[model samples]
Target chain A: MTRNVSICAMAQIKNQPAIWQHRFQGMLMECFESIMEQTQVTFDMDTGLRNVVTCSDDVFDARTISDAAVTDVVGAHFRGEEKVAQDGISALGYAMACILSGHDDLILVMGHCKESQSESRNMCTNLSFDPFYSRPLGLDYLNAAAFQARAYMEETGLTDAHLADIVVRSRQNGAHTRHARENEQVTAKEVMASPLVADPIRQMHHYPVTDWAVGFLLCCEERAHEFTDNPVRLTGFGSCMDSYFLGDRDLTAHFALKKACARAYTMAGITDPEKELDLVELNDACAYQLPLWAEGIGITGKARGPKWMEAGGMDKHHVNLSGGMLNGNPLMLGGLARAAYGFTQLQGTAGINQVTGLQRALAHGTTGAAGQHHAVLILEK
Target chain B: MTEKTTAGLVADIFATMESRVIPEGVDGITANYGYIITGPGGGQWTVCVADGRVTVVEDLVTPDVTTTCANDDWIAITLGKLDGMTAFSSGKLKVTGDMGLLVAAAGFFEKYQPPLAEITVADIFATMESRVNPDGVQGITANCGYRITGDNGGEWTVCVADGKVTVLAGIKDPDVTTTCADTDWIAITLGKLDGMTAFSSGKLKVTGNLDILSTAARFFKKYSPPSAGPEEAPEELIVLKQVLSIPQTFATGPVMGHFLNALKEKRILANQCPECQRLQIPPREVCAECVVRCKEFVQIGPEGIISTPDVAYYASPDPLTGETRETPYCSCHFLLDGCKDHETMWHELKASDIPRAERGVRVRPVWNDTLTGSVTDIKYFEIIDD
Candidate 1:
């Protein structure tokens, strides 16, 4: 990479179902202040923070151009600001692009989502479908994922029991995480017996609805050292979009994720993902997605997710040390949370969730129904 | 021949076809035709002319040829003012099913006259795309939904792409959706009722992006609100009300379930983590400090000391249920027998204990006569002088 973008600082509040006493702006302000407090990066129109990138959705935030809603909190003092209405991880890719393009140097990336604000999160997701085909059929992310899960399970012969194991590990891992929603570990029996939400998928199979916000300060390599002593460079970024119609896609295939990872890895000069990367922080919105997405990103072999999930495999592999997506984190902000956790891991400030010392990490996030679009990033210490 | 609607125009074409002239240079053509005239005055009409007999009906009859266009264009085609070949040459008139049949159908009708222009609320929406003023939203695409109430009770979806607007009949996931009474909407559009007045009076409700809708107003040509008639305000208004019932259930995981169930036996249990020596009064799964699972369940105090107690002078209303509990109640946290300081469990203290509610005060759980496996099984904890 010509000019590597490094993360100066990162901060986030623990995932909460609702923070009714205060507004979302306050939550974002706290994250903003915390990041500034760590890096001491001030926003000066002359030579400091230049542009801001925000990850938000009109439907999710119940408003359009949602970045404009958080101006006072994030980058009102900057030279420019742009909002990406996709998943949070995608905004990181966009911010990196802006820096590489020589358009801006220091960029503040903030992402937030609150599932507690809406009556049902599914209602917001259902609207993402094309009104003609999918919306008429009442398709949402959960049911669409159920279709993918069923197909993926049928193809790999994965069962509901295997899903329980993933949830148990996710919850157990979440216990050690700083900002996890469901921290208590559960047995396979409890997870399997949990109420059936979308057949073959118990309630525990999906990510819990949470309210969270995260922020990161990024700058070029030279500018990075000025901000922080320990700076992790963002070497590669790739994002791709797939078919909008669920019928058009092969339910069992993570072609978009694979293609995105291929582009990102190629840029980072990565030959082997499993061997090269020290840790992987991925948005596993559901338990099924963890292994399926792991395979999608070329980490594990086909149908080998369960094997890699064996008691100590994740710790050995250094995956989702911040408990990953399923334990908590809102939908749009899931990827950003993953990136925040990854940044913390590389910075060696992950506290209890920190794994064995590492050098390289992959952060990933997906958007749209049934993972129609995927984004990947490679950060190095 | 003088009917004002597209249906009337089709009726006149069929009436002219009844006498039927194949033009001096044409031959007897056996074919069916369908016309989907657009705009506010538009509708579906079928024209079938076979062996000198002509039939026209107001329905979508899949025919040998179908021409979809605006109502005015169809009228112009019938009147021969807009050349049939020219309309087809341009994209203004779209022909599907069979191309040859359209020319044949054009020859099927004779000397028809175009009618006067008449527009309606429906016309504004149908021709919305044609009225786009691209300058409104430089380079943006957004969906805006319309839900009209009272008489014109129907839904419409409008998609504004780059500077053009396309309107359709039904709902679309929108950037901003607006709901308003039909009368108020018409009054606002036609320049009769003030948009702000309608909005303030609760007649217009908008969700999603409010700015998008404001920008969308400039996307189209200015709408002329209908002229208002003399009106008088009503002295009284009736409000409609209805009751709703929603059932909800919550999960109390294994740890909390054990704590609640043990209440029925008048026994209190707490879990102690091996990594952390401190025990929890109410058994929980993982210890926050150690991040380790705690399975060692030890019986906590039926009798314990009060770690903290807040005797409130006034009751705080439940925000959700909108109800208030009795005031001057002492809400206390107890450090159960097995649990140490800082591992206190919270519950309400008995009314009599409110006077002595303070730090270092000992309390004991008061069990109800009816043993139910729930939190309510134990009444308020009473102060015990030890």
Candidate 2:
């Protein structure tokens, strides 16, 4: 009865040149086929399938009708399929819901985005807001983050150096990943010298728009053995949504992350995430979110040092080892890529960036106007 | 003079024409044109026109013709919509753009476009639909009345005729008239419910017009809210119809790849979830229940039970195929056998099967026999005995 679902097979296509010409749907199908082939799964036209969840938004121009395009790409021909209306992390949550519902055994979660095809900065206007008020004021995601980052700095006395350090370390680590985007790496001084997008947030502090697709395969214990010799069990998973309006919540604290982390820890039977988890993959779309979310997740202090170089501490819990979103953010794909990166570390397939003796890892994903929605997954080998 | 200096020198040409004032309506009259007008709060309106009468305002001392709209409305209508043409057509707008010089100057101002691009027609339609009373809401269209007392205690009754708002004569017996600050009235008209919510919260005083106030809940629906025009269609509808039209085919190498290509042939196929061990008629990446990866694909016979049946009483023209179907075409959920239990794919069923297509009825996928792995492969599934 012990089911083993390893990271049996995982693949990511990032910043590929072919995406420039081919339709995004075609690119997605190619990615899915490559993953399936690499995993060596037999194709049965009739039975033995579950659900497919796609992560995308209407704003992304690559596939104007992303949901239908994804359904067609993922082969949800006559099967149950759904698209997460929010970011990619929410799609992973939908897949998890299907698993817990006793409906299907295997689930495929995929998310991808091509920022080059659309105005990435303008995508912020699409986030849920009172159209009459916020949108008319010329407010956008960067400016909103600037307001929050300034608030956090004011509240905690954290400096721009802290953020710069994060960008430096993440880019350096990203340089080691096999699929790292070329010329994406940058140094702390270079990050600091970069032009300011908004007050308190430099251009280098934000994640870049790189075309990417990340997919994961999940299964029940019964069929888990069929896929991989060593399965990585989904020890626990939790997600929560905070107040939809940015003005309603405290900027310094991610209340959703705290609640999500608590539920995940409780389900995974871990008293201390710092002690139990060997590696951590946090969604750091902006560098300032790193320390704030760390504090929110209760991973602060010496047991596990901060991921930034300014902290001057190297603790056991390796964070953002795959460079997180800073190096290559494929919008919908960033969250799944974070989760897959965590899984790769746990499965010992994290080529150059692999952490030694990594057993348990924490994968976190966030969405919404100001990280208002959060999802935490605990994967243990 | 050089062309640039000559153009600058022509600025006073209108004054020169009027001083003759240029031999009143002489044939082939030629003169440069421009105008300057002042408004409340020292607002200045200045423009340059090549020819024709330039009416500044209606005042006898001013110009031949002057048109006016609420300044804020004028600004919003100009900056927000597609401009003067739409503004004038909507009647929320009025302009002297009809004047010859003003009409010609419209081209000069074209370079000063708004920062944001115009919203698509479909988006505007969606905005209007969401803000307006949707089709199903009851009591949303009832007639309502309201009375407002101005600051000097002068009162006026407002009647909503058809959907356009208009001032009505005062009635001794009022429907609902509550005295409130002009700010609150402005807020109410602007669609802010904070003042009203506070009124209901017992902060602001209200009296005779309580029903009218309640009816104002439909105000968002009353005004023609901003909308994307009819020209833009929802992209999803177009894609969905395209996928539905193609007949299903059964050719297969990579299941998903084959399925996408099969759309051109109109065939639909199902893949099973390996975790739940159910036959998923259409293949997918994961099972809904276990969150496990479904890598194995099995081709099940096109068939199963009708999980749900929705009969359409009206048939709108399908934009993609550009065809109008007969009314009462049935959309049903067909749960293919051997796929995940309770999982079904949606498809159209014929009118003849409507009576028999109750939930739980057995249905078999009637394939097109061409064998392309597309959803349309089996046209509509027919009711079959177990």
Query: In candidate 2 chain B, where is summed lDDT lowest over 10 consecutive residues?
Result: B239-248
* Residue A42, candidate 1: alpha-carbon lDDT: 64
Please tell me the TM-score of chain B in candidate 1 relative to the true structure's chain B: 0.36
Candidate 2 docking band: incorrect
- What are the per-residue Cα lDDT tens digits for candidate 2 across A18-137? 255444554566567766775555434333444777777666643356677556566565666788866676676666667666666777776766666654445434434556567657
DockQ of 1: 0.02
Cα lDDT for residue B317, candidate 2: 45
lDDT of 1 at B285: 52
True contacts kept of 1: 0.00
Cα lDDT of model 1 by residue, B169-199, tens digit = 8778888889987777777876788777887
- List the candidate 2 regions with Cα displacement exceeding 4 Å: A1-7, A16-18, A42-47, A62-65, A123-127, A301-315, B1-386
**Clashing pairs in model 1, backbone N/Cα/C closer than 3 A:** B190-B224, B190-B225, B191-B225
